[model samples]
Target chain A: MKPEAPMTAEQSLALITRMIDQAKGNVTRNAFYFLLWGWIVLIANLGMFVLIKLSYPYPFAIWLITIPAWAYTMYASFKRQKETSALTHLDSISGWLWITFGVCIITLIAFGYRINFQINPVILLFCSIPTFMSGVILRFTPLKFGGVMFWIFAIVSFIVGHEYQFLSGAAAIAFGYLVPGYLLKRKESQ
Target chain B: MFDELDPLLHSQLRLAVMSLLISAEAAEFTFLKEKTNATAGNLSVQLDKLQEAGYITVEKSFKGKKPLTTCRITTKGIQAFEKYVNTLKQYINK
Candidate 1:
């Protein structure tokens, strides 16, 4: 009998199909993990900002805490990308870091311009528009949801102004990032 | 019942490589190798197979003087994956 030709294209294609399903599963799980970590960082960063502003001798120095937080986040993200070969994992972390960094800078400016500035968190609403669009582009639900939360909270925060900004931030962290992230992780485990 | 499963995806390593590429927007050769736990020579061979089959598209470039190979799933690959899952469902359900 003739030696069997290398596996047929149809066969290979079939195998690749199954593989994609597995990959999709992995991608979703990784997305969740990134969101969780993102929520953690957001909560910690905002909490620190509030505490320093209220009680610390030098509140401005407190924002420096982000440097270490960023370093840790990047390190953890890099390791996960290496271990899983799941590009979505790294992408989610990188995307969120960019979002958070933007938020921090804007907040700093708001604080600096306190007397002259209207202290409008309303500006933050504009920020989430592009981010939400990006989530649709990436086709990841968690990031997409996070983006929407940003938009929704932006409106609420702006309506309430600085009075309820911290509470808004907390709610955003919970619904936008934390819950979604944990659910993704739980689904993957199943 | 088992006949419904796609024969191509039956290989262990090829399946792993495709799985890695599927999750990534793009993946480098080294990334695929580490994730699949395959040797460079072996991984390259399997990648060539996927490329030849048109299920994946590979791009070669130099990253800071180092050779880099990146892979992404083609549209054809995506369709094939969906069909394969349906086939798998038939087998499992049976």
Candidate 2:
């Protein structure tokens, strides 16, 4: 809103909030995706772990949850596309990097049966790229740490048994995604 | 000691423009105009004032033969803005 009089402190703060929301520099929305996938990965990891322990017939069925999650992610992305028009160069880079990650991860999974479904370590290895790049892009240390966590756990997954890989995945998502996601969200909100 | 709010940024239009640029790597002239609901002539003048103050840099270029003007906030502008906000906060608290 245009003000006829000089801006008050309240007006100034409100204008800052409004403009920041409209700006391409508002990468705070990235926190949403991080938290989303973090929770999903956590659940999927633990679910697979528990299913295997209980001797369930289809431990891999736990991954089916990603189908709904993927649908929701696409819907949210499209909605955001409609709400925002301005995109900074860095934002496009972050976006394209993640898209590339999505493609690579899917290809790995599709061909995973060939390797007897031992794709967890490789998937975690793939995780390092986007996570590290996003951290570098945002200049946030926590996210960079998150990326390194994935690298550590990917190696850890190789040394451990199949069921325990799920545990490491959960740990990785917790420290990696959920922690930085919450921190990033809090920083932006403040 | 109380500090005076920067007069250049105390105005609504200029402050609004600065607010937008402060959060953006860069923004288009049309984006500022549309967001502020200011007319082209008025927005142009406000942008010029900001540029003169060294609070912002405006790059005029072309996109497929159409003139494009983009604005970005400078380091000095960021310092001025932070000071302005801190002063405004003290006044508000008082």
* Interface RMSD of every predicted model, in angstroms: 7.4, 2.6
Docking model 2 quality class? acceptable
lDDT of 1 by residue, A1-190 (tens): 0112354445555555655554554442354444644565466547755875587675445446556765775677666654543455446655575567567655766575765543335444544554455455445576577778877886787677563575676676666666656665676677
List DockQ for all candidates: 0.19, 0.30
Q: Among these predicted structures, which one has the highest lDDT?
A: 2
State which candidate has the highest DockQ. 2
Per-model TM-score, in order, reads 0.52, 0.64
* Candidate 1 clashes between residue pairs 3 or more apart in a chain or in different chains: A11-B8, A12-B8, A15-B9, A17-B81
Total clashing pairs in model 1? 4
lDDT of 2 by residue, A94-122 (tens): 88898899999989989999999999999
lDDT of 1 at A39: 63
